[model samples]
Target chain A: MDIFDGIATGFATAATAQNLLYVFIGVLIGTVIGVLPGLGPSATIALLLPLTYTLEPATAVIMLAGIYYGSMYGGTITSVLLRLPGEAASVVTSIDGYEMARQGRAGAALGISAVGSFIGGMVAVVGLMLLAPTLADIAVGVGPPEFVALAVLGLLLVTYLGTRHPFKSLAMAGIGLLLATVGQDPITGATRFTFGQLSLIDGFDFVAIAMGLFGVGEILHAIEQDQAVKALTSKVRNIWPTRQDFRDSAAPIARGSVLGFLIGVLPGGGGVVSSLASYGAEKKLSRNGRHEFGKGAIEGVAGPETANNASSTSAFVPLLTLGLPSNVVLALIFGALTIQGITPGPTLIDDHPDIFWGVIASMVIGNVILLILNVPLVGVFVQLLRVRPGILGAFALLITMAGVYSINNDLNDMWVVLGFGVLGWLMKKTGFEPGPLVLAFVLGPILEGSFRQSMLLSDGSLGIFVQRPVAGVVFGLIAVFLVWSTVMALRGRLTSGAEMIEHAAADEAELEALRSPAAPEQDRADADGGGDARATTRTTTRSRHEEED
Target chain B: MSQHAYRFGALAILALGAAAALGAVQLGLGGLSAPGSGLWPFITALVIIFCGLVLIVEDTPDDYETWTRRSGKVGIAFVALGVFIPVLQLLGIILAAFLLLTFWIRFLSREPWRLTLVLAVAGSVGLYLVFGQFLEVPFPVGIIGRQTGLEFGL
Candidate 1:
């Protein structure tokens, strides 16, 4: 369908009273939860998945899409005010955003962020409207081998690019794939690993596992942190950016929109990566140079906020066109659609125009709602941080249990939720991010099924993976990425060795400074508090090390 | 946790990889074209084993959060979650949630009894109104609901 017709159909379907109510609820809940530390879009969506079981597929997806991007907007509020990045994407924003708040420009910072995010989100929607149908058309004829390529590429991209520890991420992905193989064999109808249990016959319930890993796990972890959240409740004034602030931020807003849209289309390239990349670009290329960075720079906040929001919208392209979810949040959305018996792929637009178009239309409307709601209600949302973490965690835990139980009313699923929740907490404590694992679990079946089919089609010739043009190109790109990553790892190792030496010298210098009688008054006061100069030096050094990492 | 602790985690995953591979083998690994259920799993198990080995050998990443006395709260929290299932079966969701919320707020958060009671009561009723009454989620009626004849879910 053409863009205009599809959009018209979308608005017609999405503008219904029921759909509008859900859209508002989703974004509002998304923003509120996003303002709370440690409760991200993924967990919120997982907790709410049971509510979607009875809704129309289009409505469910529309609400989920709103939650996904709405959280992006909401995360910035905490990052700016409290410097307590609520979402990963807002971490960069915290640098300049918190500084702006300290400088009493919190209102201008938030105002510009909302305006930039709106523009970015709008640009991405237009891009999606223009690009998705064409991409879907191109992907319509792809077969099993091509599917294998896409799945592998998506998995590899996410693990390699989306994680700090590639080996750990890959191991987690392997575990996820193994878990996906727990039920009956797709082809032979032979139970692979059910252990003779009836509940195992369906393998693991996606909702249960998701709620466990993200929802329960995150709450368990969040409860470990200090519960006393110091709030910056000072009323923000000067709500609009001055003319000079607008002039400085205008170029960055435009640049970030385009940059984010392009990056978001790539597998594993949205959210934090897009925002960080935009921040880096602005820092290097801005006419103001680097002096203004980390000191209430309007461009720093404007660029990243726009980029992250834009990227969140554009990330939908892959899922809609190729049935490939680029990140963990998108994977949960994929699971939701699959539960509703709707497979997202090249034929989605043709098969379910309402779902495809209605969701896209809802995003445009949701962004408008976020802008309208955020500007005036930023103060209201910030108050959510005042709610005790224990109370919030208790409520979140209850919702998780009730939500998972509602799915099939099976007690076994609750056990799964508890077990995975523990595993998730352990993973977090051990420096393993569960994002790749969840994404891999969702993609596991497609990868295995297509891989087997491709082998059969080629009469057991493994070369079939590279014989098709699309698959061949994908494999070639994967090889290039592997080689490049290896080179970078080696370079990083060498540089880290030098960095370790520098750190040792800095530690020595810090110790000397602490011991010197001519030390600064603050250092003397700190020394007097403990009267253990080595201890003071050690604490400072450790914090500096953590900051550098 | 130290690097030694991470090594143990790697070893555990390595053991799991071995066990999964054995299970896959038992499931029967056919050829590439006409594969059995075990083929994909076996390959994945091998990849897992390889990753585990790499993690064991390489310098561990320094991103882990160090556990402190505060981590004991997580243990207490898990115990509460563990008790919830039986409580849910015995008293239905509303009472179970009330008790759980009260424990979390009054004990874990160290809040005043009045605030804990207020939040616990309000939260439980609100959850029931939404999940049981509105959404009809079919939660267990339990001993109390059955004796009182007060079923509230689909």
Candidate 2:
């Protein structure tokens, strides 16, 4: 059927009482998690993935999608009030948002951000409605060789765009591919790495690994750090923006929507890049130069906020049409879908029309819910930041352990969670990006199966990858990226050799300071302790500073 | 993470790769046209070994840091989780969860003993009711629950 009719069906399905309730709960949970420092969307979604097993596939997807975008809105509350960015995507927002709050225009800043987010999200959903079907239609004709190229390129882009240390990321990806080789092989049905364990014959459970890596691992890290969070005591009033504020933000919202949507479609380009780009664009595009850009310009808040929401919405494009998740959050969603026995690809639109359209339609409803939740319920969400991490961490651990075992009633799965949890914690401690590893783990089998199929089809000809026109272009792009990254890495090492040493030394000093017995109390006495804590966390974790580099 | 740790990690990874490669060889690497299951694993193992070698060569002294008392806390937490597996199999999920929460809350985080007991009981029992009774997850009752006839209705 046509796009409009499919969306209409989706709307009809999503409007059901149960689906709407799930949407509300999803966004509500999303906002709470986003408001709390150190709990990101990936961890929250991975933690909650097993709970969706009992629900219908479409409902599960709709709820998970809500959590993803709902976070975009929820992240703004902390950035504005406390200047403590709740997630990486909101780091840019904290600069101008906190400035606005300091000038007692916090209400106006939040109001404008909410409106901009709604507009950007709506526009991107409209783009999704128009573009997904066409892309999926074209993708239906893609062959095994082309798929091999696409998957490889996707893996490369995920590493290159998502991380600073491409070699490390590449290594993680290799490990992920090797991990996927466990259990029975799909092509030959031979057990490769189960180690005579009957439970692992089917392979490592994705939900278990995800819960371990993101949920349990994150909780352990947070407990180890025990970050000191200071609550903001600002009173929010007059959430409605003035006419002047609306006029200032109108052009920025429109520009950010378009720019963010386009950027979101690119691999490794999502909320973080789009928001930073939007801020830069607005700073450059400011006419007459009346408003100071850094010192609380409404455009600074409006542009990036709009762009992040728009980018988050449009990130669904690749996953829905090409079956490739360009970012970590999308990668988790990809896993969620796979667990439901639904493989996302070009034929997803035809094979699971309800799921494809329902999720798109849910985004529209989710944005509205987020806008409302951000405005009136901002106070409640801010209170969520006050809940002690110890309490939250305990419950989170319990839920993760229990939820993983419930997936297949296998106790072995719980062991996997614990094992990966330790691995994940170490990865975090040592400055490795788990995003590429997780993404590669999800995409590895697809890449392997397609590569083998293409080789067989071409009778062992390695040239088969470049023989097809589409595949050839993709491989060409991969080659270009590989060369570019290698040159960049080498040049970076040469030119910034001293700077690298200094950065490493600075990191060492910071760790020493953290280890000092009296440091925590002294830090709590500092006026900007929350911001400093957030900054230290960001610097220590490479994933959090992706926007800066 | 220190330079020594990096070297150790790299060596461990190299050992793993070597083992995997040996296993893959036994599985038989068929020709490219009709590839065996070992081909992909063997190739990936080589990549992993290459990464490990690079890491060993690239190790820098700047990466080293002295271990602190806080790291001991992290180790304690890890040990608590490790101990939880047998506890879960022996005492049932409800009681095991209670003990785990109590230890993490009271000892690791050093919260008030009163609040620890309250939350540990509430959190464990609440989770048991939700997952066991409400969601119908088959949580094992273990020997204690079985002998005492204290069924959780699973």
Candidate 3:
């Protein structure tokens, strides 16, 4: 395991001023975009992808990878303060963070999320440094059925990630999967849902759809609710967590890091699930039945934020090792690699040690830079929120259009972005998620091509999916989750009437608990006042605000 | 009066998607007699349509009172998007895109128009430099062509 040799060699390449500078800049930009409401890493990468075209493939890969993790951490800032989630992965932060805000613990919540993210990320990176070779060795053995089942499970996990209501989350994911099918067919190389337009030939450009859904859609949502969680609240106090806060978060952070790393190593899972799952696990592990969950549980914020960063870092393993991409950002990074004519797989280590190790070294450097930048630069990012949504949205729209056009010198791609932008906005409001859509889009071709290739190898038998024991196990896990989700859904309908009031209140209350202090509460209270004016209100209100839907 | 028109809308969309997928498969890909590229397209569409149907049929939504409270901007945005497509060649990709984005930002939001215009222009310029000049990929160029790359000091 020449770990020292690998690290030393990686340093020689990654330490170059140009590569280092790009990695730092990429991490910085990624964090800034992640802090903002709209642009998460996928859009951030798409926006930056064109700029990197001139750089060495290794440098480009390193920078893009830096952005992915940087954004993962950056999202926590908004999730903690604004009670407005910056990215889908950061949504869990708002669950406890906003609650902590309402409880006047926003500072502690923010501090915990940051510290936890740092710990989780560092731990995961170290894990990757130690474990990637072995994992990659195993990953090389996975075949097509494994990927297909993994994709299905990945999308399903994301679909069920909704905190307010599981059903809505599943539906959103289903819609995302459907959207993925909008592009060219992998097996036949024929375009679907493109309506015969030349632009449609390639299927939906991921850039277009990503920018539309996560970027533009978020902007629209932000515009509609331009008011911040703290718009009317007092400035937060106690920026540092107390010793007690550390005591509470210590276990959860460690648990989250390990849990997140494991989940992230899986085919479909990534930071979002790891973070969310960690939070739930943390809550369950707590002895207090701590009402702090929606009311400012520092552990809640810290655990999930850490898990998110850790998972983002671990995602690189499969991507670099097996040529597997669980999410869109990795897919884009893969796209960058393919553009440069380099294939990412187990042999990559031997073929391009400079690139692989350089990327690894750069990841460490990028995380260090982010930890330094995330807190001190908090003011600058928050100020971005002050940039009128109109201005930001307009600029984002323009950048998307021109960027797509300039890339291919094609008007068709621009039109595709605009079209997806419209769909993105609608999906946002309608409870459809853009995450699964992206996964589906990126993997559809890979899945189909691999399936056909495997069939040809096996002479068209169903045995291909179960040929390898490891692949069989992975598919079996997916089957369990599918059945579990199905049972949960059916049970939900059966028990619906009993928990109606309780179910509805969880979301509203979580919003209330996560509030900065004065704003959302007054508005929410006023909205709910009409219903409460008559009967004994506290009990009904309490029931309405259950922790889970 | 629940605002969950999404439940019904989802089903309708699923049907349409499935039909399209089915139709595309029949159209075949590059050649009529061969396996054709269209086969995969149709299958993908079928996958989506099937999943959509499963989701819609499985989950019965609540009422629509909440849906009405929304500003109703989604439909308007859709209309604007439909119009933005053909308008591209007329104004050139850059100019048309700039206009569409600026209009969307200005009208869709409550902020001042100047900021929106500035954002649109700067964003377009950044894209021009990054994608066009820096990356050396080209766009339709509109009135300026690749010559615009020089003006940006690229």
Candidate 4:
């Protein structure tokens, strides 16, 4: 369909009462889940996936997509008021946002975040509208060799860029790939690891594993943390920012929208990465960034928040057009789409334009709903912190069990959920992230299937990978990335023990900035004198250590 | 985390890789031209083993969280859920979930008894209303209902 025709159709599809209701429910649940300390977009979506089984395909996707970006707006509230990130993407926001809250400018920080998120989301929607169709056109002619290249590159990028310990992440991904081989071989009908169980013939349930790993696992892990949270309540009087605040944030928001849009198009480059990169760029690029970064800088709050929201919107481009999920959240949406018997790829736009454009259009409306909800109901969402984490954990566990069981009406799925939940908890305590693992699990079939196709087509010649131009370019990119990562890893290892200790100390102080309201003052003072050096160190540490969504 | 933690994780992965590799070999690894069912799995197993060895040789980073006294609660929660699944068949979802929720809220979470009772009842009934009734999830009617001749949201 043409762009204008798609837009009109999208509006027609999304404007119905049923679609609007789903959108409202999606954003509302997303906002609530985001406001709560433990649940993130991934877990929430995984928990709700089975429930979407009965809905229309377009409506289901529109709602799930709404939750993904709406959470971006909801996440800023906790960051600003409580100094606790509602999700990983909002971690950077807590640095300057909480500082602003302490100075009685909480409203200004939140207001700028809301305004910037709206602008960023809208801009990204426009980008997606224009870019995805063209990308899909280009992808239509791509063969299995390119598919192998793309999947391999994507897996490598996520492991290399998503975590600090590349070896561990790679191992997790390897495990995920192995897990994907459990049911039956795609080429041959022989089972690889079913172990004689009838249910094993179908392989493990994706919904069950996801809900277990992210939902049950997170709740189990969350219960172990310090549950005390304090929201700055007295100083939230004015909801609008001062004119100077707007002036300071305007440039950052624009820059963040552009930066986030570009980054989100790349695999493994959204959520935390987008926000952290934006924060780092704003710190280096903004005029007064050096002085204002850790001390109630509206620019600092505006940049990361705007970037994360924009990245969330634009991350849809890969999933809709290429059938490659750029992050874990998109992976869940991909699962949801598969459950509805719809394959998302280059043909998706042609096959299901209503779903493709309806989802995109719903995001435009969802962003508007988020803006309206955040501006007026910020305090109400803040009050959700009072609901207590323990209570939330119990209910989440119940829902997870019920939801997973309902998927196939089979009790074996519950076993899978509990097994993965424990494994997820254990993984968390050991500093192993499940993001790469889950993404690899979703991509494994595609990678393996394409690889076999390429091999068969070429009569076992390995030259097939580099024979195609697109595949050649992708492999070349992968090689460059590998070399760069090795160099960085070597450099990291070569640092003196004392330097490593110093970096670790600086990292602790940054963590302290998130945990304690009083700590930012010391952090600000440190930032004021030689903060750039420490800031660089902190950015490197976070990029390596922080969890990618 | 301690060096011991890193060693343990690496060893576990290495063992898993070895087992999977054995399974793949038994399944028959075919040539490159006509791959067998085991070809992809064997390759993945090798990658896992390689990653494990790399991690074993590397210096341990002090980034992981260690278990505290409070971590027992996670174990307790896991065991309870494991038991709850079977009990769900015996007592049905409503009664089984009620009991589980009560135990979790009252004991595991250490909330007030009054609050625990209220939340457990509300949570169980609410789940039935949503998943069992509204969504028609077809939850099992357990021994309790079978004997009592009462079907609760089946």
Candidate 5:
């Protein structure tokens, strides 16, 4: 059947009462978690993964997919109203979003964001429908050598795109790969790292590692900081933007949608990079001379918000088609699918058309649900921010421990969770990104299997990797990224060392601003239980200086 | 001496790599054509060692801090988790969860006693009913539950 026929079949399947309910619940939970600081989509998905065990694969994926994109919508609320980024992708949004709020145009900022997000998400879903099947069909011809190259390239790109410190990321990836070898060897049946324990025979549980790293680790970090967030007391007056606002944002939204979709297709270039790139592009392309780029510019809010949502939707392409997750969130989704006995790869589309198409259909439906939920119930979501971190952290810990144990009914898994939780906390303290490590861990066995298969096929010749055209190209890209990053790092150290220090100082100042009250009104608000108002003022002042610089 | 911490971390990684390499050698690294189980791990260990060497060279002095400042909270948290495992096996998920939550809320976060007690009891019992009774997950009844003749049928 054609793609349209498949999607239609998917819509029919997803239109069921049970499936629709799951979609609503997923998006609802997604928005809630997105609005709450310290609980990102990755952590939320990891925390809820075990519950999906009894669910049908399609329904489970549909719900998880909702959470992924629903967060994009939820993140904007805090950025606009509170000058706080709910997630990394929303960091850029706070620049202009909070400015708009300061100018009492918060409604316009949120309205444009919601509309832009809906459009971007819809476009990305269409792109996913068109691109994923074609990519899968093309990938069907891939040999083991190509698979190895692809996995390696994916690991490299994700590391490079996600962090400033590639070496540390690589080290984490290496550790993850090493950890993957803990179970019995796939080919030889020889145990490598189990140390003779029977439970070690099956290897470390994926759910336990994920829950520990993202969930428990995040909780520990949050507890140490103990920062209480204040909700916006000012009512969001206008939920709809004026014609002038729409007119200004039209091009930016369109450009952001396409840019975000393309970027999202790349490994490690999902939510964060897409929004940053979109913001840069919008800044460069804006023709309105009177409008300052970062000072409450509609394009600023529209572009990044749209792009992040679009990127999140399109990130599913690689995972669904090539069995490769482009980022950490997708890695968690991949884990969810694996636990459901569904291997996500090229064959996934052909084998489980219901799951593939049903998930895509659900994304489109999810966008509509998010828009409906967000535009009306935004105040309600803001109120949710009042729930104290202490209470939330306590319950979250209990749930994580219980949820992880349910995976295999093994107490040993709890040990794994606690161990990784400590490691994850240390990694956080030291500025090491756990994202690359988790992704590499998930992809490590596949990479190793493919590499060995290629070796065996070529009679153990290393030349087989470069001999294949696809593998050769992938390897070339990997080499280019490595060389380019090294050159960039060297150049940065030589030329921008002073500038980097200044940037760090400014970042410290910005953080300090967030912790204190900036203005008399804000001081009053803080005195009245508003927590910190200096964060908002500093954001505006800092952005102005950034514009000047 | 903050720079020494990075060097120390690098040294730790290098030591780990050396140990892994030693283990890999014992596992038997065959030739490339017909690889042994140890070949892949051995190569990974070498890569880790290279990374450690590079990290030592690139080490900056300001990265490390005294562990005592924040380590107290992390140490306590770790101790709580460590205590939890044996407690879970001995006392059951319900009692274990209650104790864990109470400790975290009461001691770690310093919430009020009434709030801590309410949350600890409600959270643990609610989770038990949801996960054990409704989801039908097989949870250990432990000495307390068994002694009380209270069994949750999975």
Candidate 6:
């Protein structure tokens, strides 16, 4: 019948006690991981991927969806309380959220974010329920060439949103694609890059690499740096938002939801770009005299938080419609779908309407669950770091290792985790973002496959890309992005060079400030962590030193 | 000669990846077959290698002494992983995991035995329930469990 009636059917399937329980569990577990520093959706989903084997396809996807969106709900807690981001997507949250905490408006900010995120998530789920099947129906007519063009466009959009570092992002993505290639040829029955380990025969398990790169890698970096974030006392002066705060945040939340959902529909688009774009949007809409954007602004928290949630929910669009996933996390869910013998494309609704509709309804359920679970537990989460970082770190490593081993029961998988963990640790130290690398690796193989198949299908004629209307539009977008990124990169390089020279000229003044007693506290603690008094002194000293420098 | 040679290092890796990919292509012409799986996997490698070459050629280096200092923590993490491999097969999956968790939590995170033991046991049992019983995937039984598989109905 109608889309709403379809969603009603979805609600009936998703409302069953068994399915509701799964959503609750998924959201709770996801929120916990999201609250913890470095425990992100990709790693958590990867670690839990094995357990989905027995679940009904619909049940498993609903649960996975719960976890994916649930993380967005919990991410703001750490960002606001400890000034530590639980995931890269939440980095923007810390800018205003912690500032609000510093200004004694932590409770209000948290309230706004929780409610804002809920609204955003609900809006996107509605989009998914309405749009996914319609899009899948439309995609039915597309050929290999169209898919390849769409994939190229996805890569370009992801790379473009990758900001001034599109080259690095593209490189990481390219490398990831190559890594995806390291398995046996399914059709030709030839070993491509196994280098002879039997486990390598199936190629690398996505779970293993996700664990190695996202989970184990993050733990290694967290431990290696040994930086303990300070927890904020719940000095939530205001629990409810003021009328002014609500008025200011309403339009931004609505805008973020629309922007985030649209952006997330594109392949490889997720947390980073959504957050950044939301921040940019908020900044652009600022009042004339309000230049206080970077130091801490409420719009910054409200916009990004809403955007991240909406985007997270909308990510299901491609996975559900095209039978293709844009990121590693969705890829794992796709693998789960494959195990259940249901391909994820245009035929999903036609063949299995229950599966498609049930998941969309479950998102609505999961968002409600997350709101219930996260708000009350915010107090517990805010103070989590009060427990020794060392103790938490040990448990994190153990769980991560155990999870990694469970993935394939292969020691080599654990070794891979260690290798990437070390690399991640190094990258963190070196100011390189590892998120793009992992994202790259996930999308790499699929893009290559799509591109090559399109070429082969048209007998190596580049004209095939433009021949299809959809494909042409997608490629046109890619061309624009490529051109824009090139110009931006050149400008960025020049500006950075200029900035570096300016810094070099001011080096002596910075050195004097560093030696000064009033230097910033984190830098002072960086030298030594003798006691509380010492730490406070260090922070104070560093701030003053920073001022002089 | 630059302070950070990572660009060169990255380039070297890229060069190596490219050379390896060329060798990979010699084995197949990339899927003329059903799903065309070969086309994507094979060509992706070539792109990565090319990008690696670009990264190397356009490399930028930075001072990196801080990374070298955390060798102790890194060493322990790797060693813990090495210990886990042989243990899962010899010891029971639950016992092996418990032991692995204990060492990692107790030593790596440097927590007390009380906390580590509880976490280790909880983790193993949770894992057994999910991956083994619920999923119905047989975990690798230890020598002891294997010898007594049917007896315990494992």
Return the lDDT, model 1, position B90: 84
Report the backbone clash tally of model 6: 10
Model 6 per-residue lDDT tens digits across residues B29-129: 54443334455655656666766765555545432224455557767766776776677767756777677778777876777889888887887777666
Q: Give the candidates in order of lDDT, highest first.
A: 1, 4, 5, 2, 6, 3
Q: Tens digit of lDDT per residue, candidate 3, span A108-149?
A: 877777778788888888888788877666766767666666
- Model 1, residue B134: what's the lDDT? 90
Which tens-of-lDDT digit does each residue in A118-191 have in candidate 5?
A: 99999999999999989999989888999888888878776655554556667777877888888899999998
Interface RMSD of each: 3.5, 3.2, 6.6, 2.6, 3.8, 5.1
Residues A1-549, model 1: lDDT tens digits: 788999999999999999999999989987887777557788788778888998999999999888888888888897788665566676567677877998899999999999899999999999999999999999898889988887888887777655556777788889989999999999998998888888788787788778887778777877776565563644577768899888889989999999999988987767766786788788777655543666778998899899999999999999999998888888989999999999999999999999999999999999999999989889889888788767788889888888888888876677789998998777766756576778889999989999999989999998998889989998888889778777877676421211221222223542332222222111211110001011112223223324434
Local accuracy by lDDT, each model: 0.79, 0.75, 0.61, 0.78, 0.76, 0.64
lDDT of 4 at B28: 91
- Error of model 3, residue A262, in angstroms: 1.7
Per-residue lDDT of A1-549 in model 2, one digit per residue for the tens? 898898997898788888899888888877777677656778888898999998888899889888877877887887788666666566567667877887888899888988999999999999999998999999888888988888788777666554444555667788888888899999889998888999789887778777887777777766666444564756677888999999999999999999989988876657766776787788778856557665678998899889988998898898999898877788888999998899999999988888999888888888889988888877778888766666777788888888888888878787888888888777655545566777778888888888889879999888998878999999999999778766766676521211221222223532332222322221110101011123223223322223223
Can you list each candidate's DockQ? Answer: 0.62, 0.51, 0.28, 0.65, 0.46, 0.36
Candidate number achieving the greatest DockQ relative to the actual structure: 4
What is residue A317's positional error in candidate 5, in angstroms?
0.7
lDDT of 4 by residue, A43-107 (tens): 78888898889899999999998888888888788778866567667767887897899889899
Query: By DockQ, highest first, what's the ranking?
Result: 4, 1, 2, 5, 6, 3
How well is each residue in B106-139 modelled by candidate 5, as lDDT tens digits? 8877789998999898988899999998878888
Question: Candidate 1: where is the Cα deviation over 4 Å?
Answer: A233-235, A288-291, A491-549, B1-3, B59-61, B152-154
Q: How well does candidate 3 score on lDDT at residue B35?
A: 36
Which runs of model 3 end up more than 4 angstroms from their true locations?
A: A95-108, A160-206, A212-248, A288-297, A493-549, B1-8, B11-13, B20-46, B59-108, B112-154
The residue ranges of model 5 lying beyond 4 angstroms of the native Cα positions read A231-234, A287-290, A493-549, B1-3, B61-70, B85-95, B142-154
Ranking according to TM-score, highest score first = 4, 1, 5, 2, 6, 3
What is the Cα-based TM-score of model 5? 0.89
CAPRI-style grade of the A/B interface in model 4: medium
